[model samples]
Target: MIDTLWLIGIGTGSPAHVTMEGMQAIREASVILVPHKGAGKDDLASLRHGIIAAAGSTARIVPFDYPIRDPALPYLERVERWHDEIAARWQTALADVGVSGPVALLVWGDPSLYDSTIRIARRLTPQPTLRVVPGITAVQALTAAHGIPLNDVNGPIQITTGRRLRDHGWPIGATRLVVMLDGEASFQHLDEPDLLIWWGAYLGMPEQVLDHGPLADVATRIVAARQAARAQHGWIMDTYLLGRPQDAH
Candidate 1:
């Protein structure tokens, strides 16, 4: 049985984003689990390794193949099945490591955000003592990259997935919106004439890109840039903020 499980958030795509507490957890853990997302995604695994290296940690590093979700199934059902498979993979990795001391998993961005590491950890048999060291989130990175605030003065901001934005237009009562996990620039589907956008991709990385302007004017540019970035890098992580002008607040 595991003794302690540390969920360390490494922030979004930057080794420098790792907090001191997160580094300490990495140094102290007997085993560190890194998930490999297969070909063309080696940068993700390398980033985790780089974090460990920068921390000067000698902890045993274990790499395991990540499970791919079936695309045929409905979204929710596929995600549920995928999480189950991932948990099982984690268990197997732990067994292979044969460690009884504290174990750590390097998570991308803050676990409390749109991440599932915490939920998957709960499914483990004889769950270990859990510890979460929060790190910077994509929302924070995106805003920081563009040098803007997340919300207008005293206005409520809605954080949502691209699917939601695509399925339903902006929700009522949300004057500002931050969209994440959107492969499709759902902002193109919005009909809000006054809306402006601040978008960023690969934040904190050397290949970072940022854009902002009237939605109608810059939406096409953002989509073209996103497509080009994805083609160039084979993968991309991006987030965007949408809202009316600051004077409207």
Candidate 2:
């Protein structure tokens, strides 16, 4: 039985994103839970395996098929139900392993971001001591890969999802928004012509694609490219930053 649940951020499918502290935690863990998202997303699991392999840890790996969320229901309700299923899955995975030592899970990107693994961990009947090892986030990965700053100096950045951006207008207060998990290029809906966008798909991977320009000019291309990439690969992970240049207005 694991006495400690260590949620280690492995970054966005890259071993290089693992910090030394994360590596140390993996080495100390007796068992690791790796979630497989079926055939299309096997690489996601493979990346987690690679991180453990690189860390030189002999901890036993327990692989589980992630339960897909029901999209028919309201979004928040669906996520809540999905989280319940995932927590059940986690309990089942840890059942036979014995919880005497540390248990680790490699979360994509940082756990504090959009990940629900931390929330799931809290649902355990006998909650274990939790430790978080921060890794590169999609925001950081995209900005660094493109050599762009996340926000203007002395300015705040709002991090939101594609769904929210599409349903709600641009968020109030912050001019810069980092959008993630957008299935469609929702920026095309923005009526403002002055808005500029820096978009990236499969960032940090060899298949990475980047586009930047006035939203009106590149919106069509971005949507087309996103569709093509999704069809080519079984799955896709993308993020974008929207902002107006400081000198523009």
Candidate 3:
């Protein structure tokens, strides 16, 4: 039986991005669960390991293979099924460790963002007390890396996924938008001539890449850079902002 479950956000790829509270949670937990996303994505697992080591935590590190979502299914359905499987895996991992002490899982970014760990954790049987340690979000990391502000003065910003941006176009009422979980560079789908984009890949890491300009002028370069980065690293985590400058008004 689990006593407490800590969902600690470790921030984007950089170990230094981990917040003090997150590190303390890592050091205090009796067992820390880390997900292995297979060969091409081992860097993620390695990053988690490095964080644990850097914290000087002696907690037992449990590694479990992450479930792959079936692309054949629709997006929502596929993600729902994948989360069920992941919750089951978490339960099994906990059973294997056979620990009743506080358990922790390191999340890539703030759990409240697009991440689903909180949703999956809710599915666990005999629910344990949940504690969340907030960490740096990709939007923050991306903006900071580019040395820019997230939104124009006195304007609202919409945050959404690549799929939504592709399927629904930009939402109304918000001039500024930040897109995440976009593997297809959804910005290309928009024909907004005045749109400006600030894109970053591998933010906060050694191989970080950033580009900004009118969408029409730089979209091709962004796509090529994204493709080359994925080819070189086998995977990529990226986020971007697309909107017109305040002066355009």
Candidate 4:
């Protein structure tokens, strides 16, 4: 009965991203699950494999194909269906192996942030005991890569998607924002004056790319760089911090 599941954060791509605690979780598990999101994105899975290998984990590695969301469904519905499908796959994979001890999943970042792994884990037949080993988050990596503080003096930080920032406008009273899951490069449409932008793609990876300046000055450059990087790598995971010009030194 695989009732215990270790949700270990593997951090962004770098092998050094996984924490010592995360490494220990990998070593203690009887099996580890890795998800593959189809073709042209082999690097994502390979990165996870590399992290596991670097951790010196001897646990059985089980790879599963992630389900694509149905295009016809509404946005929320599509995500719900996709999550259910993922939960089923997790169950089948572990049961098929007859895993007896603690099972683990190498989450890309801290399981608590913008990740549905914990939600999916709860969908299991009889929910497994989840112990999360936190690792560095993309937000942390983005700020570090750019050598900037996440928030201004006595300012509140808002973390939202590029879509929300596009649809609803800048969050009211937010002095800074860390936008994620923004494939559409939504910042190009913002006409706010004195808005500074700091963007990075493939954070913590060898092929990392970064750009920062007044949004008006560097929007086009960031767009071009994002396109070129995605074309070369077949995938991109990026985040950006937006703040007023006064926020920067």
What is the C-alpha lDDT profile of model 1 across 1-249, one tens digit per residue? 567889999898888899999998888888898999988788989888999989888889888889999999999999999999988998887785678688889999899999999999898888779999999999999888877778777667889999999998889877889999999899998997788898998888888899998999999999999999999988999999998886233
Runs in model 2 lying further than 4 Å from the true structure: 247-249
Question: Could you tell me how far off, in angstroms, the CA of residue 47 lies in candidate 2 after the best superposition?
Answer: 0.9
Q: Model 4 off-target regions past 4 Å? A: none
Order the candidate numbers by lDDT, best to worst.
Answer: 3, 4, 1, 2
Q: Pairs clashing in candidate 1? A: none
Residue pairs with backbone overlap in model 3: none
Q: Estimate each model's TM-score.
A: 0.96, 0.95, 0.96, 0.98
Candidate 2 lDDT tens digits, 1-249: 457889999887668888999999999998999998887888788778888999999899998879999989998899999998988888888788766678899988999998888999888878789998898898998888778888787778899998998999798776799999888778888875488888888877777888887887888998888888888888889999899867123
- lDDT, candidate 2, residue 41? 82
Error (Å) of candidate 2 at residue 22 is: 0.9
Candidate number achieving the greatest TM-score relative to the actual structure: 4
TM-score, model 1 to reference = 0.96
Q: Identify the runs in model 3 with alpha carbons over 4 angstroms from their true place.
A: 247-249
